[model samples]
Target: IFFRSAMALQLPSELWDIIADSVQSDSLAHVCRRLWDLLGSSRYVKLNCDSHCVTQRVRPLARNVRALQVKVKGPWDPTGAIDALQHAPFLHTLTLSNMAADVTVGSARAMAAIRTAPSLHTLTLNLGRNALGTDGAGALAALKDAGGLRTLSLDLWGCAVGDSGAAALAQLKDAPALRTLTLELWGNAVGN
Candidate 1:
């Protein structure tokens, strides 16, 4: 009796496209780098700006990015995050994470960068560390028009946002294509 060997089948590009499209944008980096390597040239990417060597890492994938997130591990300049906006013309989603009390993106440069990102439609700002005061909220509210925002999530855990700040965020709902909104304002002084 003789044994037969099994043949390996390579998946088609269309099937890969479907799989890639189904992946949640937030879960990209966690999906294993090897899988991304297997996908080769056509693999989509999201900019994850952490405390690592961000400059080198971002330059290459900047053009292909569809979504972007800036997470500060230590003291990171807001300008670095703002500069990234210029490279990603195709970017549609952005997440700015400032997990430190001393750091805030309330700079004019950052606001200008947000204005330039016409393709941006989704925004998630985790401004828990730095207090996203009413001023901060107002600045971000202007971004609601950036690419006709579709989704917005503000994790203002320690932000001192009273009625006025919340009021500003409310304007985001009036955005052109807004479909989802999340507000986390724990320990805030928002009175009814």
Candidate 2:
């Protein structure tokens, strides 16, 4: 009936463009993939996706992307996602948000992988509402070895890391490339 007729008609070019733009505006990651497919090449200069989707999609688009923002959902296994980021050879900025403290053990592997990204200049991890504690901070501090990293931000607004965690993060003071550091702690105490 009407549905069949509509399906038979070819969509006008203008109509398709409208749809594509709508999709792109709705979700950055989806737009990246769609543009990649439509242009037969990659065109995304910046990208934002959850850790899981990034692990699944970023490898193919890595060569063309310059900046990346990753939001990790709670209860995540940091190792797999971190390994996926390592595959991106040209990434310059990385933002990890909503990481779970309970997953720190697996995150060690991710930390190791991040240490190897030659182009990563900025790293931000938001543990604001999760479980990352002193141990987790210690593990993240290990990234000081990443030669190109120049900026780091850690947010632990609702966690249980006290002075011990602050001490661990202080280790970054010696990082040769680190030029900026930001730490946010709300519900935790770090000796005033």
Candidate 3:
């Protein structure tokens, strides 16, 4: 009875706003299908998707997505994820990772998409054990344009980034609002 009544309750849009603001839409959406639909337009949903089916799942929920996490497991084609992000204009946080050697310069294209998202405040990328050399780090320099980005955690461990790549990364100091920055470049060729 409690579950049915809760689902059936039709509160005013104002009341719903109060409820939605205090609670995360991701957890509420998991309670039932009705709640998911109710929160379909809420900008608090945290969505997790893999490279495969990312376009399908993210496109529909793009407007509602506040945080997004994508992991590249198999072949690393960034096209789908890039397309999906274009629709998510309100997305504030993003986490992308590929823990294998296959993640290559294609990730540079992903950075291009990221640079345009002004609403994004936090970004975490773990592209470890790949072959993204100086060029890839140079691509990351585009984050200097992300005016709202406050936190950035980049794990390019063993991605063959030498001194030149480090210099490119140093350009992030120009990001206006960035307050916290973490770079994990261990197992690389960066020198003093």
TM-score of each: 0.67, 0.68, 0.81
Candidate 1 lDDT over 123-178, as tens digits, reads 78777756657777677677566556777787877777778988887887776778
lDDT of 2 by residue, 32-112 (tens): 454334433333334455555655665665654445666655455666556666666666777766555455634643654
lDDT (C-alpha) at residue 137 in model 1: 69
Taking the candidates one at a time, how many backbone clashes does each contain?
Answer: 2, 0, 0
Q: Which residue pairs clash in candidate 3?
A: none
Q: Rank the candidates by lDDT, best first.
A: 3, 2, 1
Give the root-mean-square deviation of each candidate in angstroms.
6.1, 8.4, 3.3
Best candidate (score: TM-score): 3
Q: How many Å off is the CA of 93 in candidate 2?
A: 0.7
Q: Per-residue lDDT tens digits of candidate 3, residues 1-192?
A: 644676555666556545765675556555567666776654654444455765676567666677777665654667666666655777888887767737666666575567666478999888888888988888877877887889998898988878999888888878899999888988878995
Q: Which residue pairs collide, candidate 1?
A: 100-129, 101-129
Instruction: Report, for every candidate in turn, its global Cα lDDT versus the true structure.
Output: 0.62, 0.63, 0.73
Error of 1 at 19 (Å): 8.6
Which 10-residue span in candidate 3 carries the lowest summed lDDT?
42-51
